[model samples]
Target: MKYDALQRLLVEHLNSRPVPPHAAARLARVRAAALARHAQRQRQRVRLPEALGRWLTAHNAAARRSAWAMAMVTALSVGYLGWAEWRTPSEADVDIALLTSDLPVEAYLHPNFTRDL
Candidate 1:
């Protein structure tokens, strides 16, 4: 090839849009190895939070089960409270109690009933 053609080929290759396959492969390997080494070093220098995170993930199922159990207990407690409120004695219950007792209904129903007691 002519010297001018060789110079043009060198310039074009240098300004190429895509990388050569071998260079790309080598760069990928270097980057991957660097990242792997960083991760390994980070693991060796483990912090409390990282260790705790690992522990939590390892017991993920147990954590989920405990959370579900707590939720069920809370739901049951709320439901029981609602049921108790609904079952509370009303004015009718007082009237029924009065009727069942030996005392006269009118005396118990009188305005002075509380004051008399």
Candidate 2:
């Protein structure tokens, strides 16, 4: 109840007093100066060396991440291909199979053994 009464009194006191015209002009000048300072601060921020440093830091992080991803993909592809190759039989194994077969030795020596000349 006391707070409400105080608030009502403050409202009545504020409503009774009229602001002078000079105060509005002074407020306008202060607002313009504040806006000008804010603009100047923004301009100075762009001109500072730390702005370039921040840009370079962000750019380098993205580049590093991209390079690392590409390297990992390449490594995994090469590793998978190497593993597949290891699973398959080699040229030496094919030669041994051919040499140990029960077919005639002359048949193995012919270049077109399966086809008629």
Q: What TM value does model 1 have?
A: 0.36
For model 2, where is the 10-residue window of minimal lDDT? 43-52
Encode model 2's per-residue lDDT on 1-117: one tens digit a residue.
999999999999988978789998999999999999999988764656887787778787778789899999999999999999999999999889888898878886798876854
Q: How big is the RMSD of model 2?
A: 10.9
Which candidate ranks first by TM-score, i.e. highest?
A: 1
Candidate 1 lDDT by residue in tens digits, 76-96: 999999999899989898778
Backbone clashes in model 2, listed as residue pairs: none
**What lDDT score belongs to each candidate, Candidate 1 first?**
0.90, 0.88
Candidate 2 lDDT score at position 91: 96
What is the overall TM-score of model 2 with all chains considered together? 0.33
Candidates in order, TM-scores: namely 0.36, 0.33
Q: Local error of candidate 1 at 27, Å? A: 6.1
